[model samples]
Target: MMKTPRSFDHIDTWVFDLDNTLYPHHVNLWQQVDARIGAFVSNWLKVSPADARKIQKDYYLRYGTTMRGMMTEHGVRADDYLAYVHEIDHSPLEPNPAMGAAITGLRGRKLILTNGSTDHAGKVLERLGLTSHFEAVFDIIAAELEPKPAPQTYQKFLKRHDVDPASAAMFEDLARNLVVPHQIGMTTVLVVPDGSQEVVREDWELEGRDASHVDCVTDDLTGFLQGLGAKS
Candidate 1:
């Protein structure tokens, strides 16, 4: 593993996305939540399952989150939407001891910044054996139902925790989500799959993977975190 850049040494707070960023994409844990999202949309809109997926993706693209779009256009209750979509089986996810060790090794206030609910983040963290590492979970409710890539949501997060963006690092699986963090002067790391995972993502979400805003990219997040401890 390559030594992590010295720029990350100043980061006193570590912020991470919870979904694929925490666990491997191959685990298919999110696929269940995704299906439930579609199911919620279907039930709410009285549309077929096939049609619901289309609407879900469209809303996700139009707004930062489908929940936000649903609330705006359909008067859908935010809490209800979050509760319904997150009722998935998390048994498929396996714990990553290496990643858990790496996270425990990092010297900083670790935080979970997710578009999902705190309940969902909590469950996934427990599944991955990482529930104790993070100090806080900032979920959709905390964001006022506005997800990441929205500058205001990030501002809210930083303000809520008294975090300085320059002294923080943000890790995420989607390149688009890193744009706001990068622009706000935080070190941005894009965590990707190792080509072995069968992950699903929208075309736009993959667009800026190599863009200037992305300071680093790694398929192995645990290795990347471990590399940060290596001698320069």
Candidate 2:
């Protein structure tokens, strides 16, 4: 049932981004963390909530991640920031055995490359019942705080896994993050938010669906993977 054997025949590594990429955006789990992020910035800078949001977005745009921006420009402690932002309730997430089955079908070494901490990745994967699907996790801490879209971060990940770019695929929710991977010869897939997403997203984040670097785009990751030889 493979949709296109030639497209994935050489792949031996499957890299996934945690958070919005692995799960549907409608889960609302990340909205809680996002709100916490704004609050943390407001408290840290003694700025109004509105101003804090601006600062947060600005940093995210400029540095690929708000945490990296905070560290580079404001000397924020990584551990404290990560812990504070991720303290919200985990009740929003629900396990998806179907998705796990699809992931289980991929014929390669699976991995998670995330800008967030590994602890957060563990919690999300556990909730999704996908903890065993991935073999290794390359988190922000492993990147030395450099976020993705940074060529060097991707380089380190590729080197660590001994991944041949031509034989690997990376799935990410953020379109911009795939730029470097595309340039380096990896097949890049963009996981878009489904229609069920009631959560608001920035206009800029939604603007890159037509970007040349993205090899595939899909709102239903399960179907996409299934088409690529996953089980129903």
Worst 10 residues of 2 by lDDT: 1-10
**TM-scores of all candidate predictions against the true structure:** 0.94, 0.94
Q: What lDDT does each candidate get?
A: 0.87, 0.87
The regions of model 2 sitting more than 4 angstroms off are 1-6, 230-232
* lDDT tens readout by residue for model 1, 3-46: 34327878889999999898887786888888888999999999
Error of 2 at 134 (Å): 0.6
Q: Compose the digit string of candidate 2's lDDT tens values, residues 1-232.
A: 3232126767778899998888888887788888999999999999999999999999999999888888898999999999999998877778988888888788888999999999999999898888998999999998888998899999989888788899899999999999999888888899988886485678887767777888889999988987775422
lDDT of 1: 0.87
TM-score of 2: 0.94
